[model samples]
Target: MKNNILNSLKNKFEQTKTEEKQIQQYFSTFDFASNEISESDRMFLVEKEQILIKQGKVNSDSLYQICITLLEVSDRFKNNGERKFMKWYEHIGLNKDRVSELLKRAHLYINYPEKKNLISSLPTQSVKILTKKDIELKEVQKILELGYTAVMDIKNNITNLNDDEKIKMKSFKYFDVKSIQKIQKDIKKMDSKEIFNAKKEIEIYKKLLKEAEKQLEEKEKDYDNQNNLKLLEAE
Candidate 1:
């Protein structure tokens, strides 16, 4: 029984590996951006990015090179900060705050020099964990229209607010941490069956989303061609 279970797991793992390779190959040859060469170039750049991330995982030398490249690129387009080096990450997304944090992390490693091994081994997504459990009530009022970034950013500044308000914010944050930790612990404890079901649900959701996109494209293909649509942004 144990041998059978191990074999089953190994087969699943190999299947997942095959799927990932298939995805990468499909994207490599896919004409996702045949219309705009710039978009096609972006795909290759992102592929290099994934390779850098995988390399950075095992080798400190690899990480140091990545950090150096990122920091240099950031500085090269110093004036065009957001426009040049912005990509979305969940929770904090790729906003000004995340950019600031990336620069700060890169500089810390650069200045320390010796800490490159430790810093590089550390996952960048770990930085996104620097979030409060809940936004302060006053912060809730101020950050309403802002997107997910606002959801992550809670103001701790007690400038104009009273002592009672400060205490309230602190208490809320304390509770938030405790609640989030408990939820994460519960999630980690889910059984294999539970985890499998969750993953199956996700696969179903992804297939449905792709089907919807396909249907929409089919329906609008003529309309889009006729309209030659371009979205305008107002300064």
Candidate 2:
């Protein structure tokens, strides 16, 4: 009876593995991208993550480590602030834990272009960065954890902001109305050219804002129309 039970358990495991393989094959065409994530693709990601978890392939700590390492090297993720992070996360449609894992994976992919296959592998989360002293270290994730904004500030050759500039521009998005009023007051302290440039930027932003509002209005109308149709059909 024990031998029969063992055989049954082994068969069940094999069947599960086969199912997981088929699931992966179904989504193999849905390539990962920040902007191109559709509802179906998002569901696929969540399902695949679940299978990976059941198969003992998901490693959270190591994934977090890869993310930290990427912050020190890559520039692809929207780590600029909590707002950007949230928007990006929502766009990707990953659950919190999966987001954290894939976020780390995205970071590693950006920073370590040479290690793409290794980084994507479930068991491999190793990261390496040279210190100022040029020593190669293995335990890199033990260092201080940087916030979302700080991670977004990681610089590269094509990056618009340098290290010092990124620090200076760390963020003004959290400024209060009073602080903004103070900024308005201080703007007169600027020279003429700076004021002129600022005015041009303000005008451009106004136009863009109007366009965004128009787009939102159209979307709302479409949603309302769909809801009305649904109600009529129910009637």
Can you write out model 1's per-residue Cα lDDT over 28-131, one digit (the tens) per residue? 44445665658657777668766765565445664355446657877776686545455422222334553454555566466556545554433333223222
What is the alpha-carbon lDDT of model 2 when measured against the actual structure? 0.48
Per-model TM against the reference? 0.27, 0.24
Clashes of each: 0, 0
Runs in model 1 deviating more than 4 A are 1-57, 80-82, 87-101, 122-235
Candidate 2 lDDT over residue span 1-235, tens digit each: 9999999999999989997786666544445575678888788787877676545433333444445553543244446565665565445443344444445555555555554444444221122121212322222222212111112222221133335543444454533456446658979688988888778877886688567655665665465345334423543
Worst 10 residues of 2 by lDDT: 141-150
lDDT of each: 0.49, 0.48
State the lDDT at 63 in candidate 1: 39
Q: What TM-score would you give candidate 2 relative to the actual structure? A: 0.24
Among residues 3 or more apart in sequence or in different chains, the pairs in candidate 1 whose N, CA or C atoms overlap within 3 Å are none
What RMSD does each model have against the real structure?
A: 21.7, 19.7
